[model samples]
Target chain A: MSERRFPWEAVLAFIFGAALGLAYAWVLAPVQVIDSAPEALRAEFKDQYRAAIAASYAANGNLTRAQSRLALLNDADAYQSLSAQAQQLLAAGQTRESQQVAQLASALQGLAPTVAPSTPTVPIAATSTQAQDPNAAATSTPIETETPLPFYTATARPTHTLIPTPGKPFELGTQENVCDESIGEGLLQITVQLTSRRQLPGIELILSWSGGEEHFFTGLKPELGNGYADFNMTSGVFYTLRAAEGGAVVPALTAPVCPAANGGTFFGGIRIVLQRP
Target chain B: MKRWVWILPALVIGTALGLLYGWVVDPIEFTDLTPETLRADYRADYILMVAEAYQSEKDADLAARRLAIFGSDSPAEIAASALPFGRENGFSASEISALETLVAALRAWQPASGAAP
Candidate 1:
């Protein structure tokens, strides 16, 4: 055999080709695929965009910034869509939340005219006399009617006001007595009587015992008067009474002693007076 | 024939090296993902972030809208789906509980028919 010849060039070519292939396969190809793959759902992106707008609105209370962010959705009918959502929420009986959504929709609607029109200058009347003249008002009726009619109609619908209901204030010098008495042998009756004797329709009393609670609202028993309410307590059990409004506890009279069962009849009938604090 | 014999070994070695680099040494990670993936654990973290944002903003509608993107039919379902993932991912107990409360609020806001049973 002739002196052995080494194919160094072929070996080098093979190494180079292998490195290129590896780089292409490992680094380039997968990166391209990842870059092309859909990252998030359209709905998800919309939600995120809305969240960002809300956050910006909250941070600065800036309607302009919020509207600018909302415009990113590129939906010309975004306000209408929000309004529809609000209506749907209302139909679902989510009144509070529906009102909130409706407000956002209205805000977006308010921003539309300011954002869309390129003309920055407002039209000025030729003379102040035109604004004051009755003849001018009569002549401009058509234009005025055209523009303000929609504004009036839009404002006519009462926006739901989320005012917190105030707690009923007790009249000064008002006093009430809650008494428990034995009606007959082994029977007891509890009664509430007001010194002013004004029967407030909404005042409520809640009585809690060992494992139960009962509510006594005024006017539930018309005979009890507006401020008058009562509940019979089970003998041999301790109970606490509290005045309440819409589930909120208010200051009320507490029984001085827990009613006790006496072999045949109940004992410990006590009367306590509640005064306006 | 003898000169061409080197071709087979070179081809084999080159292919082996390429595969080694591609699969082991410099392999690409297709699984590396952005927040857009919305994976279970990622979604749990996102919901927590939204909740924190809501606490300061106090915007219920915005919160509900953000949550709806998860594609759950109801907030209860979303809570149910996220609770385990959140727990597994080491989310705080308070965060998990707040999510439950949020679910209840959202459920209350949902229509009776749309609410989770």
Candidate 2:
């Protein structure tokens, strides 16, 4: 009987040992997995942040400090301080801003065109001179009639100078490509011979007059480097053009105007002649 | 009685196998990311890219930046801006609308720093 009891006791001890071992494998083993989870997530979050920064810079050519903040998601303390300037700029409306902060917040993000307009098609077999200015004297003209009989009469069309319309703003640039939408004022009517796309930095155009309300046009903040704007000036004001970039203004062009300001800013940086009604 | 004792070992082995399966392969059910999530990612990328470009290249000139991003104004400039925009944002209708607004605003804005005519 005693021998029988010993075997039963041994069986009970074996069951208790197996239970303890199973508990360790089931509970303790998964704890390690749980421990590694946050780290893995943190790494993935970092990758997402970097990808965002790279995309933003590639699209806009500049990064708002706020964007940089988003990239540093792991460092919330640093993000708050660094993004202050960007927040202020947005508040001040200096930069074109978006309503959403993160893609996770909404489904409608990135619906805009990824590319700008396609290149315009130029006419085939067109000569440079003809293509540039067909009105030049060297271009072909209709033959003159010899019979003085008709007492030729020529109607003269008056050439009108461009002046800003009241309450309208003028910007610099020419026109929009067929595919891309035109931003800002498009001086499509005026022809500009574009020389350089770069800005003439440190120059400011000031409105000076002998007697009138003080007016000025300075400190250009470009949205996308497509075009810029200038104020319409009244006749008899001394107009001084200056370039300003990186926070300093430098003189670039100055003209004493006895005439009114030209059409709303011409795109592509060209001289434009406005028509009078 | 001794033969039945073997049952204990088998039960223990089975439990161990179950635990291994649960820890390694139990929770990995497949679920794809939705199209909506992808769309959100795309939008986030575009806005952030535009904002960055405006700040750096155009010196924060909204009009010029828009032109650079949208490629409006002369075909040549448009082409130039287009490559960048396409490579980054790809052609989309919403981008076109944003470009339109930018052009309108710039055209109407009389810069404090007068741009040469």
Best prediction by lDDT? 1
Stretches off by above 4 angstroms in model 1 are: A6-277, B1-9, B19-40, B55-60, B68-79, B111-117
> What's the lDDT for residue A170 in model 1?
32
Question: How large a fraction of the reference contact set does each model reproduce?
Answer: 0.19, 0.09
CA lDDT scores, all candidates in order: 0.44, 0.30
What lDDT, from 0 to 1, does candidate 2 have? 0.30
Task: Write down the C-alpha DockQ for each prediction.
Answer: 0.09, 0.07
For all predictions in the order shown, the interface RMSD in Å is: 17.9, 18.6
The alpha-carbon lDDT assigned to residue A77 of candidate 1 equals: 76
Model 1: clashing residue pairs?
Answer: A199-A226, A199-A227, A200-A226
Docking class of 1: incorrect
lDDT score of residue A253 within candidate 2: 20
